[model samples]
Target: MNPFELLGVGRDADEREIRRAYTAKLRHTRPDDDPEGFQRLHEAYQRLLQIRRHQANQQPPVTMAAPVAPPAEPRPASTPTSVIRAEPVFVPQRLDIDAFCSEAFGRAATGDNRMLSEWLQEQPAFWSFRAKADIGQQLVRRLYRDEPAMPTKCLHVLLNFFDLDHVHAGHDALALQRLSRRSQLAWELMPEHRQALAARMNMQRRPLERCLARLQRPYTWWRALAAGFTPNSAKVMPQFIRELAGPFIEDLPPSVSQEQIRFWTSVGHKNPVSGSQLLFMAGVLSMLSLVVMLGAAATTVFSSQTDMPRLALLGIGVAWACGLLWVALRYYFVLDEWLSRDEDEPARWPRLRLATVPLLLVIGLIPCLLLPLSRGMGFTFLLPALWLSLRRYWRRHDHEGFYVSPGIARIGLLIAIVALPISPSWVFAVATLLAWGDDLRRHRKVLQLAG
Candidate 1:
């Protein structure tokens, strides 16, 4: 082959083209990396260039006489030549779990229930779901030819329609939707047989459901409040109550039953407040409220009436009182009721009561704070009280699974940090507390080290 053609570049190709082609070919046939291949290409180029150069010089042509033919021995019988054609190279397809998951999610998003049901029915028996138990088993037998891990989530969703109190159905519907997206990706990660095994694993979902049910059945007051109507029976679902009460029996209050203990554990698992710490928080807040109120009344009655200093003092006093009241209601009232009572109604009131106090107090205090104070002591008290109330409220509501987002907290923090120092108006601080505090609290709960 011509050297230029071998390199796959034009004859009149510039040095750059030659270099580029050489680099491209070098990656595949590394004569330095592969000595024999490198030598062959190098030799071909040298021979072609040398011949071209010789032809360009154009010396007189020299001719040599043809050699006489040698006498041949008896000719061997001609052998047939066999021709073999090269097959095209195969390039294996790459599959990723995430990509497969995305594809599955896309299929689900089309909202074709028959197609969705058909696809799920094709899975291993244990992992399958049906509209009803009898039909589900028949489908499983038809699909898997044997029992397998059942898709508990699918069962829960279906069972909820039949009036079974499947607690997970309501909250986990969205979670299940997301998890199913990951199934496609998981499918891509395994071979056909392993995929079948995964289906089998899913088929055995009863144990997992039982375990989850055991963990999940207890009723927190928040959950009950969300469920609507007070709980008539202190009896938590049997499976859940047994597991949660065992570990903390000694730590539980005298009034608490095995059922109440189960419920309290459920509450603690769901919320930030728990153990003796919540009581401490309540005590602190109650004490702080009394101290702040005394200071506010003393200052307002005795101190000289000036706008800024008096206003700042009043702002601080009011904010402190709000925080104190919140801590008291949350710990001493709401949480206590939830801990003691069979249901959540009493506990929920305290949370609302506390949440309102700061907003109302802040509204009244803001105008006063904007006025000039005789001394900056008002701002000092106001700052801490504002910080504490904001922080408390923030922590109360915000959590990993809660509605608050991190971006919201960061924006509010930036605004508060910027405005609270320079702006005489309490708006910045209040906005920050309202917007970011809950988000911050939620984040802290997720990231916090256990005390």
Candidate 2:
């Protein structure tokens, strides 16, 4: 089947258009009337959205052409299926060792040096990841000997080494204090390599900064066109960027400080091809789905003498139901994010978001809804909207690299306005409008608490 038809929008529809259609459709479905069907619609919508969003950003496309079955490497019969052993291989050394050790550890006595050498040898990541270069190792050995005049960078390296590679030594917490210490001892402990790493990261920040500026809405009239028409696009990025970048965006620090956010954002934004690809594909599929639904709806309205429109609506709704079911099956992984709260913050949003789920489900199942529209049409419109509202409210604060800012109230208001006049359509549209509006209110309450 054409992916476009699957999403319920027109071909070549932009992200906003696709989003509008999706929200409108899912809002119509009553969740309790057919929970299983509602779930399928959600899944299809999620996957398609991810795909299109990546495409819009000029990222690489992800194809699920054949279920992407994992490579069937032959395994020993006795090996356990669940055992996991991951080892990082192929990481490059970034620090200069000769200067680090000579400057930092040269001041120490032989006995003190000997103790530090043993400690360095005990770090597991060094051995497992093979991150130890000869120069870095030599510097590490000297630091064990109490090297003098060690740079603060050298101290930072040791701190990272201890924090990331040494757990059993019980020095993890000490590393934090060591980093924060405002003394000569701390400065001497810093390694030259860490300084280099920081410098390199600083250098890498410019491109991400540029991309951020380019992607921000309202910076340029017809911004997408401006981005698309840029000349000499030989270096144009691919579309699969979000597959690589979404997690990093989620990981960015939530501080309001511009400098801090910039530093974190630099570390997160990578290749944009995946992101572009997701956006494009999602836009296309959703648009196509919208076209199909609209065409079917129009046909039903014009062909009032026959039950063809009803049957077509039923068909569209079934497809949507299947989509929601797909989402439900993968709900565990996605749903868990909604429950996660920042360790420093009181996690009010997560609590309220969870509390609203049952309410959504109940509101999702007003009997008046299904009586007017068949389950299939309901699935197409209602399920996607519900999931989008839930996801938006849950992850409202995450917006660094991936484009997660969806106007929930705007979408709700649009649905409500469009829903009022229609007869049979009112049931599906009204239900969706209510769910989205409720979600928006809940989101506002949490935002107030956060403020």
- lDDT of each model, Cα atoms only? 0.43, 0.46
Q: How close is candidate 2 to the true structure, as a TM-score?
A: 0.20
Q: What lDDT tens digits, residue by residue, belong to model 2 across residues 145-229?
A: 4434334444554545434335554444654343323223333113333243235344344443454344332322233223333
RMSD of 1: 29.0
The per-prediction CA RMSD against the true structure, in angstroms, equals 29.0, 36.3
**How many Å off is the CA of 253 in candidate 1?**
27
Worst 10 residues of 2 by lDDT: 232-241
Q: Which runs of model 1 end up more than 4 angstroms from their true locations?
A: 1-345, 348-357, 360-364, 367-406, 424-428, 435-451
Worst 10 residues of 1 by lDDT: 123-132
lDDT of 2 at 130: 32
Candidate 2 — which residues are off by over 4 angstroms?
1-218, 228-336, 340-345, 348-351, 367-370, 377-451
What's each prediction's TM-score? 0.19, 0.20
> Residue 249 error for model 2, in Å?
16
Error of 1 at 268 (Å): 24
